[model samples]
Target chain A: SQTIHQWPATLVQPVGSPLSLECTVEGTSNPNLYWYRQAAGRGLQLLFYSVGIGQISSEVPQNLSASRPQDRQFILSSKKLLLSDSGFYLCAWSVKRGQPQHFGDGTRLSIL
Target chain B: AQSVTQLDSHISVSEGTPVLLRCNYSSSYSPSLFWYVQHPNKGLQLLLKYTSAATLVKGINGFEAEFKKSETSFHLTKPSAHMSDAAEYFCVVSPIYNDMRFGAGTRLTVKP
Candidate 1:
């Protein structure tokens, strides 16, 4: 069975602070990875997706960026955090494109 | 372009009553539809998915959804609501690979 792990299940940061969230999948290789943000009372917004290492497609223009360092390791980063950046961030992986994605527990980020 | 619409932003149902969460989608081609459930501050768990194979799909936790091509709708239903079923549900549409759209989500509130 495949499992996704996300670190820092909850985070609190001050404005202008750096942000880093990591996601890793076990038991699968060369899977599609995705980053999503869910604001309060809103649906999830896809921030970025990667098909392979060093290949990322951004869906929204924002302060956040994503990187795929390894076949199953993905990272979401920001040089500076904004108040609007506070939300629940999720990491998901799928065996192939157009397939059902499996998600991690998510990171709740609170910016002050 | 592909889009998904969840009919109700919030739905309240008494325990033991039937549950219905309506969803509509728009796609240029034959689309893949999915329903995901999220608990408070948790990751998304896929409830069901509809490919071209089955119009009626059964999912985990006694949940089921019907896909109607003529109506462009994929509506989720359950015979009896349970307290554990109270959560947010999202409808998703994928027209092609790497192109997935999510609905605003419908919050299901099950009352004891």
Candidate 2:
């Protein structure tokens, strides 16, 4: 069975600090990875998605970016965090396009 | 382009009562639709998906949804609501490739 894992389940960061969130998939290969942010009591906003290593597409322009270094390892990073960056960060993986995506336990980030 | 709309922002239902959460979608092609549930501060889990197969799709936890192409709707339903069913539900749509869109989630509250 395929599973996705994300780290630092919750984080409190100061403004202008750096941000890094990692996501990895187990029992899956060459899976498409995605980064999403959800505001409190709101819908998910797609931030970035990657098809393969070093390939990423940004859906909404933001202070964050995403990278795929390995086949199943994805990273979401920010050079300097903004207050608006505070939200619930979620990582997801899909075997194929138009298929259901599997999500990891999200990282609740609070920027002060 | 594909997009989903979850009509209800929140719904309250008594235990053992029928549950209904409405969703509508727009897609350019034969789209793939999905319903997902998210526990508080947890990852999103797939409830069901419709991909040009049967209009009625059954998912985990005794949940089901009907895909009505003419109405462009895919509403989730359950015969009896359970306390454990209290969560956020999302409607998703995908047209072809990495063009997945999510609806603003609907929060389901099952009262005892």
Candidate 3:
């Protein structure tokens, strides 16, 4: 069985502070990784996706960026956070392009 | 390009009643579709996916969806609604599996 893990589960960050959310997948190799933001009306916005290590694609231009440091380890980071950056951030992994994605518990980030 | 649309922003249903969440998609060619559920402040869970095999796909928790090519729709339905079924549901479309587009999401509320 494949499992995706994300942390810190919940986060409270001050404005202009740095942000880093980690997501790792187990029981799979060379999986596609994705980062999404869930907002009230905007729905689930795809922020970034990676096909392999050191490869990331930005779906929406925003204050966030993503990185695939390892085969199964993805990281979402920001040098400086903004108030608009507050939302539920979810990480997902899929075996390939046509497969259903498995998601992690997500990190609820609140910008103070 | 591909996109998804969830018909209802919110729906209220009584327990044990039939549940239907409408979803429609647009794409240039054959695309993959998926239905996902998310609890409050939680990550999205894959309920089912349509990858061109079967028209009717069954998923976990007694949930299922039918893919209608003539209608360009992939609507999710449950025989009986449960209290646990109350959550946010998303319809996703992928032209190449890696290109994911999410809907605005339909929030299902099951009343006692």
Which parts of model 2 are misplaced by more than 4 Å? none
Best by DockQ: 2
Report the C-alpha lDDT of model 2 over A55-93, residue by residue, as the tens digit.
999988878888898999999999999999999999999
* Backbone clashes in model 2, listed as residue pairs: none
When sorted by DockQ, best at the front, the candidate numbers are: 2, 1, 3
DockQ of 1: 0.81
Each prediction's TM-score versus the true structure: 0.98, 0.97, 0.96
| By TM-score: ranked, best first | 1, 2, 3
Q: List the residue pairs that clash in candidate 3.
A: A97-B97
lDDT-best of 1 and 2: 1
Q: How far is candidate 1 from the true structure (C-alpha RMSD, Å)?
A: 0.8
Top lDDT prediction, candidate number: 1
Task: Return whichever of 2 and 3 wins on TM-score.
Answer: 2
| Local lDDT at A15 for model 3 | 100
Using TM-score as the measure, which candidate wins?
1
DockQ of each two-chain model: 0.81, 0.84, 0.74
Q: After superposition, how far is residue B23 of candidate 3 from its true place, in Å?
A: 0.8
Give stretches of model 1 more than 4 Å off: none
Clashing pairs in 1: none
